[model samples]
Target: MNKNSKNLLRFAGIFGLIGAILGAHMAGSGSYAFRAVHAHILVVGWLTLFGWAVFYKIFQTTETVLTKLHVWSAIIGSIGLTVGMWLYMVKPFNLPEGVTLFIYIGGGVALLLSFLLFFLLTLFIKEKK
Candidate 1:
């Protein structure tokens, strides 16, 4: 009903889409070569973001710069991680191996930073008297 809820639902839809693709891939290929990527998409993209959104909604936290940063970081981190891992798994983009590794590492760091920001936000939550 609120912005946080909307964001969570939107990301839930994203997870659903990724899950569908994963299911189809498994059905057709019978190989989980991209399993890590799929997992990241679900966990980081769907679960983490949804969890934070729920937290924000329930706590009635006002929108802050950190919240916006969290949203963007989560989005970018998820996409970067997913795409980077996919490229790492399969050279679909024809990028150099080192470049793919860099992307994967960078994505991981970005995701970590987002989590840290979330933690910071939690610490700053106003307590109900």
Candidate 2:
């Protein structure tokens, strides 16, 4: 519908893809622990973030700093996740474990910043009710 809505859908799709991958692995009675990182990347990485973006769009959620924070954080975070996942999937390119973890930090940082902003903004922003 709009740029933000489109973004939400895009992110949500990515999340679904991750879930599907994890689901496939689990279908064979795989361990959840093994998929723990995938679960976070999907849930927090895609689902939660996308859902929040959608919610913000529908509600016209407003927070000057926080709003921007949400956008940039999610954007950067998703990008980081993509890089990390890519490295994980295609290791032939040659990468170090530290670098891989750093890439994941991008997503983690974004998620953290977004949530932190949400918390701060909710306090000052008037509730609809």
Best-matching candidate per TM-score: 1
TM-score of 2: 0.66
Q: For residues 1-129, could you state the per-residue lDDT of candidate 2 as single tens digits? A: 546557766777877787778677777775554365566667765777677666665664554756776666776776676567656555546888778777767666776777776676566644334
Worst 10 residues of 2 by lDDT: 120-129
The RMSD (Cα, Å) of candidate 2 is 3.8
Model 2 off-target regions past 4 Å? 26-34, 62-65, 78-94, 124-129
Which lDDT values do the candidates have, in the order given?
0.78, 0.66
lDDT per residue for candidate 1 within 24-128, as digits (tens), equals 897799987767777778787778878876776667567788887876777677777778888988788799999998888788778788888888888878743
